[model samples]
Target: MGKMIVRLWRRGFLSALNRGGDPHISDEDLTARARHLAARRHLVAEDGQTELTHALATGLHAATELLEEAGLSRRDARDRAGVAFLKSGQNLARWSMRLWLWVTPDPVGHAKAGNKLAERARMAWGSGLTVHQENGPDHATLMVTECVFVDYFWDAGRSDLTPILCAWDAQWMEIVNASDRPVSISRSGTLAQGCEACDFCFKRKAKLVYSAPFWDRLRGPGHGHG
Candidate 1:
């Protein structure tokens, strides 16, 4: 898990740094920063959530610092860092969903596989994520009472970044459940936003006229019929 966080942080941090347009950040500096992050393997939280939260926060902080050094104001630096973090999360989710689809072959199966893996991970890491699932004919509702990410970030006094992390849940769901029926995730409350719990409602909406397969959509035009 520590190694995984290090790898994720390295990917996000380097991607953000390269795109941040900071003249002072060189190849040598990048290597040094990677080393610095890797050396903090001891910072891995018992629940695994704080480890990832800290890693993402570190990446955002690095981006904000670089942008600030490049003459951006605090607000501008944070905004840019947020964009970079969001892009990194989306890229990671897309890659993960593709890999899951390759293994599971069907979207529903892929989603179930992912849910099982996530549940196992939470149990293994003692993440304390509580959920209630309701299955319907065409949709499912998952209500989460406790989230490790929210708990960790709030405890670490970095609650400001929790929303950024929470945003990845929707991004991942969209990627994994991409379908003609408009699979959607709706959340009303989150622990990060001072709510008691997070309510994730995943539902399949009406089908679209021009819905395309996930792979075709991912590959863009010229690969599938319009």
Candidate 2:
């Protein structure tokens, strides 16, 4: 996972930098940039999930800085970084969701699968997750009161990036629900926005008529869509 993240970050960063007439950024320079951002953000490359998340955050921070160096404003640079990161992982996200749907053939199975995965993730991060699970015949909901990503970014003074991470959840869920046995997620509040908790309600539906425009919206003209 760590190596994959590094590759993703490198690819995304170079892709963004290429737009400014230079794709020849050296690997050493990129690594130095990420290390610099990690230092600025107080992110340590600890073991397990800490290392993974911090690496991603550092890479994203570096990407933003590179974009800014290319003459974009801070806001625009961050926006571009978010889009680049998302686009880089879209294929993986889709494949993972499809595999999950294949393994969990029914609503109950799907809910259980989700719970197991969430538990593993929580254990990996080792902090900042409070989950409540409610399961019914046709639905399952996971109410998260505290999110480690939100806490980590907030403490790092990069809380603005939390929404970009939250948007990935919506994107992945959208991919999952696109399966035959559609399971839709309804989220109202988010810790990123200073809400008490993130209310994620996943319900089984015969036909879910919803489209996630997160990517398109984020890539739009202005940051209004964010």
Candidate 3:
């Protein structure tokens, strides 16, 4: 996840040159593209909602694609994705506090950045931003948020399942993707069968499996079985 964030940041910055807009592509344009892509497949919302508007559709589609491609187990993917969203300037007026902290050492600068990021995230998400502790450095959570935001990229279709699966994983629920049943969780919290479809899932399956006992032990004494 850490590597992915750095990679995305670098790609976003480089793309900004020819792409125009902010450090990343404009969210409006991206949303438009998402709608177009989704429409072609006749995707519909869960409740038979109207097709996505051309204006907001593309950006939503792009966000979804980015998340799906990020692969599950990239714990930080959400936060990083969120940062990228902010960079596009579609959600808020400025970069997030984490961004400021990442770039500078001053606590005040970090606070300012954090407030800006939080404000934008709330605006984009409607409700206040929800925070979750990802299993890595703080940046991991930011990337995960960004990845989740990508779900807006496409209209709901079969593809919508990608985000749904991601959400379950994001919440650390025992749900399975590409399978209908709950995945086997060992005595430890790790999954017995990895989600092969997820890049990170596939990569970390072994390690997670091996660490199951430790994870289980780390869970408070009375926590559910891993």
How do the predictions measure up, each by TM-score? 0.62, 0.74, 0.24
Window of ten residues with lowest summed lDDT in model 2:
207-216
**Collision pairs in model 2:** none
In the order shown, the candidates' Cα RMSDs to the true structure are 6.4, 10.1, 16.5
lDDT of 2 at 183: 66
RMSD of model 1 against the true structure: 6.4
Residue-level lDDT for 94 in candidate 1: 81
Q: List model 3 lDDT by residue over 172-193, tens digit each.
A: 2222122222122222121112
Clashing pairs in 1: none
Q: Per-residue lDDT tens digits of candidate 1, residues 44-150?
A: 54546655654555555555556677788867776766766777767767887656554432333333434653464455334447775555555555667787557
Ranking by lDDT: 2, 1, 3
Candidate 2 Cα errors over 4 Å, as ranges: 16-26, 123-132, 206-226
* Top candidate, metric TM-score: 2
Would you give me the overall lDDT of model 2? 0.66
